[model samples]
Target: MSIITTATALLADIAVETDRTDAVQAFVKQETILVQITTADGLQGTGYAYTIGTGGTSVLSLLQEHLLPLLVGEDARNVEALWQRLFATTRATTTGAITSLALAAVDTAVWDLRCKRAGEPLWRLAGGHRREVPVYDTEGGWLHLGTDDLVKSALAAQQAGWAGVKIKVGKPHVFEDAERLRAVREAVGPSLHIMTDANQSQTISSALQLAAALEPYDPYWLEEPMPADDLSGHARLARSTRIPVAVGESMYSIMQFRNYLEAGAASIVQVDAARIGGITPWLKVAHMAESHNVMVCPHFLMELHVSLVAAVPNGKFVEYIPQLRAVTRSEMTVRDGVALAPDEPGIGIDWDMDAIDNRRVS
Candidate 1:
C-alpha cells in the first residue's frame, strides 16, 4: 500500500472569490494546479496548489517540465526522499520560490493519498492536538474597499461570531492609515482581538512610526509591517515597538523561520502552505515555531489550515478571508468564534467541480 506509480497532473481553472470592493484592494484571480495520484489499490487522492495572478501557467510549466518526471514511479510514501530529490535536482535551474512552490503541489497530493488510504483525517494522522482553532475573520484591505467599507466589514465579521479581525494599513500617508485603524478598532469594540497587516507594504521608519501611532488601540500583532525578507529590519522594529511583530507568508523554508526566530523578527509566525512547499515543510516550521515559543498563525488555505493549527500546541488564530467559501463545495463552519476541523479522511477538501469548470481558462 504505497504510492509507487506515477500519474498525470490535472490543471484546473479555479475562480476563487475575494470580498474586496474597488476601494480596499483589487480582487485576485487564481490559476489552481490540482494534482491527481492513483494508488495501486485504485484509490485516488487529490491535492491542490494555486499560483495567483499571471505567473500560474509558468509555475505549472515548471512542475511539468522539471518536477513531474522525477516523481513518475517513486514511492509516494517516501515523501522526504522525493522532496529531497526534487530540491537537489532543481538546485541549478531554480532553487527557491519557483521550485519550492512546485514541490508544494507534489507533496500535498502525496499527503492526500496517504491520508485517504489510512481512512483518517489529516489532523488525526498528523497527531490531533486540538479539536477546533479560534478564527479571526481577516478583512479590511483590498485597495478597493474604502475606509468606510472597511469599517462595515469589520463590524460584519464581529456580528458573525469571529473572535478577531484583521485590517489592512500602509496607506500613502501615515495619519490616514492611523485613522482607518482607529475606525475599525472602534467598530470591533474593546473585547475582540484586532490585528493589522501591511502585506509587506511599508518602509522601516514608516512601520515603526505606524506601530507607535496605533499602540493606543492595542493590536494583537502588527503583521508584515515591512517586507518578509528584512529580518534584521523586522527585528529592529520589534525591539522598538511594543506591538508584537507578526511575520511569515513570505518565508519559504525552515531556515527562514529559524532566522526569524533567532532574530526575534516576529512574535507570531504565519505560514502559507502553497508558499512554503506544502504540509511537510509547514509542519517543520510549526514545530520549530512551537519550540521557540512563537505563535503559529497560518495564512490562507483556511480549510487545510484548520487541521494544521489543530495539530499544533502553539497554534494561534487561523486567518479567515472567506474567498474560498463561495467556491469550495464544503465551506468552513465557524461557530461562536471557533473554526471546527473536518472529521473526514484526508485533508477533507470537497472540491466544487462546477466552480473549477467555470473558472478554467485553458
Candidate 2:
C-alpha cells in the first residue's frame, strides 16, 4: 500500500462564457481551486472546486494550509476514512461553504486516485448504473434574455435534441416571468421540457403566484424559489405546486438534504459534486435521494456531473453549462441529446496545464 507523499493546490480565475445573468446576480470569474495529490509510488490524482465569483483564495488557502497537510502521510486508498477524518476535523466550519469546498478537493483527489489504481472510470467505480445521460441547456436561458431571444434559444436547444432548457424566472412581476415562459413554451411546443429557476429570489407569496402563472406552461421543476435555510417554506411550496421543487446546489451538507427529504420538500436533488464535498458525498446524496424516491439532476460543472449522473439509478438530467473550456483541454462529449461519461481513468477532465498557468492569479 502506498502512502500519500505530496499535496498541492492552484487558484485560477476563469471568466464566464457569456453574461450569465440570473435573478440574483451575474457570474463573475470562476475562482477555480485545483488540488493535486501524488503517492510515494508515483500514482497521482487531480481534483478541483470553484467559487462562482469569490472565495477561491480562501478555499485554496484552506487546502494548502490545512486539509492537504493532513493528506501528506495518510493512506491514499482509504477514501471514505479520509473523508470522515477531514469532515470530523472541520467540525467548526460544518455546513458552511469554505470547508466543504476544501474537503471536496481532497475527497475528489483520493477518489480519483482510487479509480486510477483500480483501472476503472469514476462512473463505474461510483455506481455504474448507465453509460450515457440526458442533458438540458442553461446557457440559452438567462434572466437578461428577452422573450423573443428566450423562445429562439429554447427552440434551438429542442432542434439540437437536448432533453430540456432551463429558463430563469423571478421578475419583479410574476406576469413577466410567465410571459417569457409562455412564449418559449409556445415556440418550442410542449414536447421539450422547460425547467424554471428563481435562483432563491422569491418569497412564499411570490413563488406561489409565479407557480400559479407557470403551471400552464408545465415547467420540469421550479428551482430555488426561496432561501436554502427555509426548509419549511420549500415544503410548503412543494405541497402547493404541481411542479417539483428542485434543490441542493445551494445546499452544502448531506444532513441538509436529509432534512429536505424527511420534510418531503425536494422533488429533484441537484447534488453538486463540488458543493456536496466531492464525489464521495455526492454519491451518498444521490443514493439518499433514491431512497426518498426523488431523482437527482445536479447543477453546473456538467463535465464532472455527467458521469456521476450516469452512475446512479435515480440520476436524471445533467445541466449543460460549459465553464471549464479555458482551463481544460477537452469539451464534454455530447451526441444528439445525450452526454457520455469519460471512459478514461482519473476524474476524467483533461486539464491544460499551460492554460491553467495562464489563468492562474494566485
- RMSD to the hidden true structure, all candidates: 2.2, 0.8
Q: Residue 50 in candidate 2 has what lDDT?
A: 88
lDDT of 1 by residue, 72-117 (tens): 6677777788778887887775436666777788888888888877
For model 2, residues 140-250, the per-residue Cα lDDT tens digits are 899999888888888889999999999999888899999999999989888999999999998899888999999999999999999999999999999999999999998
Q: Which ten residues in a row are the worst by lDDT in model 1?
A: 18-27
Candidate lDDT values, in order = 0.78, 0.91
| Clashing residue pairs in candidate 2 (N, C-alpha, C atoms within 3 angstroms) | none
In angstroms, the error of model 1 at 66 is 2.0
Q: Model 1: how large is the Cα RMSD against the reference?
A: 2.2
